[model samples]
Target: MNREEINKLFGVTDEQLDHMAAEYESGKWEGGVGPIVPGRPRIYDEELETISFRLPKSRVNAIDARAKRNGETRSQFLRQAVDDALLANA
Candidate 1:
């Protein structure tokens, strides 16, 4: 649907419709289009893969404490550590 159609349908001004259209085109519609509906597919990039590993309670606490000391989350600390290790090994 075009901007004019959207403005007419939603009883909004032409400028508002143009702004909405621009936002949609830029993929900034986080709450989804128009009214909420069930089974609407969410589109996002799949560039990063999620991995989970379990460590001992002590190790987990240590990691969390170290991360807090460095003013970073455990995940961020692990990511930085991995990047540093990889670069050092290379």
Candidate 2:
């Protein structure tokens, strides 16, 4: 993908990528570019994927209320709920 597509898909800024490049070029490069990894690092050694589904209006409103009470966005609240559920099953 092009840089613009990459930025949209990976949530990385062009300036950030440029800074990384400058750092790399400043290195010794003794091995001559052995390996390269793009994009930002994942949190908690975990990769997250986005999923979409429809929910009832009432359920959405309830989730929003609880998320607000917990000081989290709807996505964060849902992610934590799923994580908790997975742990419980495990």
Candidate 3:
């Protein structure tokens, strides 16, 4: 979808967009699109969905240990595991 579509989806007004645009064009704006926030946000390349499943306690412990050791999050470790499994099967 386009900027207008996203704006409409988020209930952003045309005047608001113009104001933000003006701020950016005039070099007064720092960063971010619409609202002012605290720290840097988590940006992803694509949209993500969450799923839940129950695993053995031991298995979860193993995952957490490995993730910490590799300096990665649980989600990252699980995504890598899924990708590797898929590629191996293919």
Candidate 4:
């Protein structure tokens, strides 16, 4: 859809639409005209670490169900749980 369509659909102000159009004309805007991919936000830093472990099938199933109910993936739910646990301990 075009900018005017998007503006009408999202109720964006005319001024905002004009600014976006100007940015597009100036080649300063680089966003794609597609649905955003969902998941964890990307973090490009050395401080981030990756760890993997295996869980029992029953536990994994339970986690998947809970995560789905909460509108999150298993990884997102686990990450938030870990952060909360650390804060609680602290």
Candidate 5:
């Protein structure tokens, strides 16, 4: 996306994006070159696929609360739960 589009989409200033772009071009930023990955390195050992589905606001709040209580982000909590459930069933 162009600078304006990106700025609009992410609410970043054009100046900040330009600075980041310069840093990335200089190879000073490790994260801007490749496909973006979600989750922290400690939590995710492999590439991740992005997925989305809508849930009720209450359900989202419940999930977020559970994840927070477990010291996990929503995505990490969901991923771990799904993996565990699938393995258990298998």
Candidate 6:
């Protein structure tokens, strides 16, 4: 998106977006190019799809504890679990 559109979507001012863009261009942020110009399709090597699943509260607590023990966030732990499962199944 253009600067105005990006700012609107992110709920930031144009100045904020510009600062973010500059930071990204300077490689201060980790990955990917920042906002694209309006009307340009975002290209991907392969598309990623998201899914949601339900687990018991206790199971979620266990996962959170395990993640913390491993010094990872819950999301990172879950992603690692998925990757491991895929590799094992393959």
- For each candidate, the alpha-carbon lDDT, in order, equals 0.79, 0.82, 0.86, 0.83, 0.82, 0.80
| Candidate 4 structure lDDT | 0.83
lDDT of 4 at 20: 83
Let me know the TM-score candidate 4 reaches against the reference structure: 0.55
lDDT of 1 by residue, 1-90 (tens): 997787788899977767877876676755455643356344335556779988899999999999999999998898888889999999
Query: How high is the lDDT of residue 10 in model 3?
Result: 91
Q: If scored against the real structure, what TM-score would every candidate get?
A: 0.48, 0.51, 0.51, 0.55, 0.49, 0.48
Q: Which stretches of candidate 4 lie over 4 Å from their true place?
A: 1-27, 30-40, 43-46
Candidate 6: global Cα-lDDT? 0.80
Give per-residue CA lDDT, model 3, range 1-60, as digits (tens).
Answer: 998899889999889888978977776776665654456565566777889999999999
Error of 6 at 3 (Å): 35
Clash count (model 3, backbone only): 0
Clashing pairs in 2: none
Judged by whole-model lDDT over C-alpha atoms, candidate 5 comes out at 0.82
Q: Quote the positional error of residue 6 for candidate 2 in Å.
A: 42
Global lDDT for candidate 1? Answer: 0.79
Clash totals in order: 0, 0, 0, 0, 0, 1
Higher-lDDT candidate among 2 and 6? Answer: 2
For candidate 2, lDDT tens digit of each residue in 12-90?
8999777777877776333475544556545557666779999999999999999999999998899899999999999
lDDT of 5 by residue, 1-90 (tens): 786887799888978878888876676766646643454445566766889999999999999999999999998798998999999999
Q: Write the per-residue lDDT of candidate 4 for residues 13-71, one digit (tens) a residue.
A: 79987798887767676567643445655754456788999999999999999999999
User: How far does residue 61 in candidate 3 sit from its true spot (Å)?
Assistant: 0.4
- Tell me the lDDT of model 4 at 3: 76
Candidate 2 Cα lDDT to native: 0.82
